[model samples]
Target: MTEVLTKRKTLLEARDLHVQFASRGRKARAVDGVNLAVGEGEIVALVGESGCGKTTLARTLLGLERPTSGQVLYGGAGLDYGSRALKAYRREVQLVLQDPTGSLNPRHTVYEAVAEGPRIHGLANEEEIVRDALSRAGLRPPERFFLRYPHELSGGQRQRVVIAGALALAPRLLVADEPVASLDASVRGEILALLLRLREELGLSALVVTHDLGLAWNIADRVAVMYLGRIVESGPVEQVLTAPRHPYTQALLSVLPESPEPVVLTGEPPDPTRVPGGCRFHPRCQVLGVGRAAEVGVDGKCKGEPLAVLPAVPEPQVACHYAAATGS
Candidate 1:
């Protein structure tokens, strides 16, 4: 097993990040003015509904996709994207993609697939490095599994191989984007346990991106809730999950399918392109309560003023005009 490192600075940071894509002759902001950080050995979860840009933000962090503006800082310096920095960044921050089979090449055996990274980077000899990576990823007794192809392994094993490939680079931060989504529910728990144990053993920080609040509840130290390219709320795991301040956050938690129904924040979320003025959530917010905007400082039916990301009661930050009104 790889010995976990001790005493390291912030592993990754993304500040004022924006990601835009041209769609229908118009620029669509996938990630809009986001800021986040991951400590040396802490796990932060990016939670949101689908199409909220969580995946895009993760991709931006990994340099798989470039942000339109803002900066992603790693180890105190801006990610350069120059040859040296790119190479270093790729090694230090790796992504465990959602799809195991899709991410792995069918033609390559497990040994070839896992060894590819070290070979491309000229970091180590193939045979020794492949064995080490497979072992590290818990394909224990590595020699027995090295020659198998993606098709030969079960979904869980294939995913482990994918993780092995990423670990071959000895990354300090692992960006897991729904890494267990495709697995069966029982297997999902096992994978989560494996990931958590890996963090403890390797001292790795993780940015786990997922739309499932349940999954976030299982593994996250902190949760940042995003809605339509903006962070609606964020804080420690228990606080944010149990006492959500933003209506959107509340809505997300209410529909979790767990027993003991939470207070449901009514109304559908507003469309991204045509977001309402001031508080974006006011359109569907039950707390808006007919001409109560002025009380919360939202003027004229949520048109009163620009929205503010306010610090709510209990250590959480919620971006909602009525966070104080909600007794959050």
Candidate 2:
């Protein structure tokens, strides 16, 4: 199926973003030349293993971290972090951290926690805003939870409270980082449902950052696979998840518990400071040697030209030379 990329109006965009940091005298490229977009009312999953730069990209998108070399566009305009516009933009977008325990204040009551945003911004009707936010986040009868503290709530409740805090500001877009990783498996469904419910009820968009492909399958409208600081594959969730084009993406999905044939690799992904030349994934591609290198289209060029994301019609965009040749 040819998946059209622009099925909705874009809400946020990252263009050739590069966010690097100095580590041990070498540059650690956490996010390298990544171009991504989240459309209005769309739930997009940004998936990758740890240290693949997904978190960094999320932070950059939220303006929590500055990109070293690219522009982060919010609603189609580049954000100038110094201006008043950036602050206003932030109020429109909010972040849900991975760990509820770490994000929620140990001392603050649910009311205080949810009320902080509006109070800080000097918005009107703090009490009403807090109740509405909590209710929207699925803490039914928000008054019942207003006096409770983080410890007084269940794992799921605490997550909902964290979510409520974000929703309090009436954000149009949410950047949820590992939103369910800290919750119990049973409660994970509840939180995921809440996210979907918020989108449906409030006309909100979301960028859900997680390594779980199943979660993406469950809720996201689209999926983007990140590897070594760049997007290797992205398209409609059903298309990219079922028919991954990049070799790295194919290897990732092959190991899914449901996959009939699972393919494994020999080594770990290379270090960020010492990434492989040409294609970052070339060193670990299993089929590179299985088929004659020439026949498989793996050659010196594959090991030399750093792969950039290729624009493909109908999405399912890829960055691997062998993707077209091997049908991966």
Candidate 3:
């Protein structure tokens, strides 16, 4: 457990979570044996490429998708899937999607969009709630946006509106999926700052689902790197990002603009439906491909023995046979 998590209450947790989708005769394992947690008022980033199951894990945590096995827990209690229980759960954990333009209905005004959640939950003082949420989301003088449409706002403002909608319910956590992916670079910074500000001001906890390592470095207290339905490495942002042990994580960081030399893995990640055996990342691992595994006498294990699922803890952990054996 990181110092942050140890000091605060665990707001959400996933234990050995698995999500599978069956189509035709094959089952796609979207999330496989994952264990993760979010501390109260902490921000954790789920980092991975597309098809790596980060999004699926986020959906499962939000109660949008039921796990094939394992559990999603809130405040140490297993989630109840009953309608009333789920509805009540959602009020405390809200989702902010990638595209603000698509997230908001064109016909709905800003007030309606922000007020929608409080109204549905039958919360009193709808106007006050909406206005406060909008202001907190950085749309100063919230009344100015009440009658505006999505088309009328800048990209950043539109995203703020989407965030405001989530805020209206007084959610304790926000699961923002690629929250700044669609915005301009400058706008992206603004949105990231808004999230930090919200956390500082409201003690908000967030699970930010994104592929951008830079964004994780900017905002997350911890980061979990996922690949082919599993977390290959995870720990405090500084430890994982600065001294990454897993080859997959090293490759990701190497590609950053500040990296001296980029490490490029060959080919795309394997299909989730037919994940490679042993180390799922071995097929594209730079260390394995360069004979480091063989030099360490772990080549056979890398191809035949699967690593155990990584436990979400404070210290950095990497689930690579070569890394574990060689202490890389």
Candidate 4:
């Protein structure tokens, strides 16, 4: 297989990534032959269904789970987990998990949790480190929240504390996995705003893993749509969301709970273990038959064979074979 070279200065790059697990005496590809890149100081959102590889990909990016076969390059250099580069990479790339409550230690106070990273890395004085992290996370009057434990704070406060911990290391890239999922509806907006503010203030890049299209629409600069361990489509947010090209992508956007009731796709998503032949989504796709194919001018791409590799597109290349059909 030929490698696709990207000219953009990628802060983090995953090439032909494959993450698999042993189950029932066979390897299950949780993340299969994936390719992804995050540009310097850019926010790229990874969106997909529940069983898709979003979480697994995020974990792989952080080096928490080693891919069976692949290369993770940090700053154009390959990630060597056993070397000093790995340690430095960890400091540069931090993760903010989905469950804020579970992520923080109940025994440790907010100050302790936030200061843990700097202490481990021996990066700063404890007092200044805690204070600075709390301040950066918008947990003003840092002293007020210092002694508070996870149970002592509200949902929003707990999430803020977690964010503070991730920021303590002053990471270049932050992988936020459903950061707002556990928060109250009212607080969701506030958290999103806080993230945007931090991005501007710290000049940090982010990879937000979310299943909610609306949230991605509101926050992400570019969106990467994942399906069954592969990126089915990816492009600028407006182009992908407003006029989605991939059949699966279009079906996904149509089901979003927007006002006026978007197009409801018939049938359900394919089973993960028993993916259909050709396009994994073809079984559930509504864009079948001659007329619809001609409408998009991508009839052959979708019908011929399951695309083993992502086809090239003009803007921010999409993985889909029928990307041009969507008129994006």
Give the alpha-carbon lDDT of every model: 0.80, 0.85, 0.93, 0.80
Deviation of model 3 at 260, angstroms: 1.6
| lDDT tens readout by residue for model 2, 288-320 | 646544686566657787776543223667887
Pairs clashing in candidate 3? 1-314, 2-314
Candidate 1 lDDT over 1-328, as tens digits, reads 0122223356788888888888777667788778777778877889988888899899889988888998899988888888887887888899999899899999999988998889888985678878887887879899999899999999999989999999888889999999898998877887798889889999889999998888899998778998877787887788788877777777778777783676555566545555556766676675675555566665453554556533211246777766655565
For each candidate, give its TM-score against the true structure: 0.89, 0.94, 0.98, 0.89
What stretches of model 2 exceed 4 Å from their correct place?
A: 1-5, 292-294, 311-314, 326-328
**Tens-digit lDDT track of model 4 for 1-328:** 0112234457888888988887677666788778888876667889998989899999999989999998888888888888676777888899998798899999998988998899888885788878988988889999999998899888988999999998889899999999999889999998899888888888788999999888899887778899888888877787778877777787678776663545555566544455556666654556654257657666556655677755322155555545555644
User: Which of the two, 3 or 4, has more lDDT?
Assistant: 3
| lDDT, candidate 2, at 73 | 90
* Model 3 TM-score (2 dp): 0.98
Angstrom error of the Cα, residue 97, model 1: value is 0.7
Candidate that would win on lDDT: 3
For model 1 the TM-score comes to 0.89
lDDT of 3 by residue, 1-328 (tens): 4665678788999999999999578999999899999999999999998989999999999999999999999999999999999999999999999999999999999999999999999999999999899999999899999999999999999999999999999999999999999999989999999999999999999999999999999999999999999999998999899899999898888889999999989866668898988999888988888898899899999999999999867678899888889787
Q: What is the lDDT of residue 268 in candidate 4?
A: 66
Model 2's TM-score against the true structure: 0.94
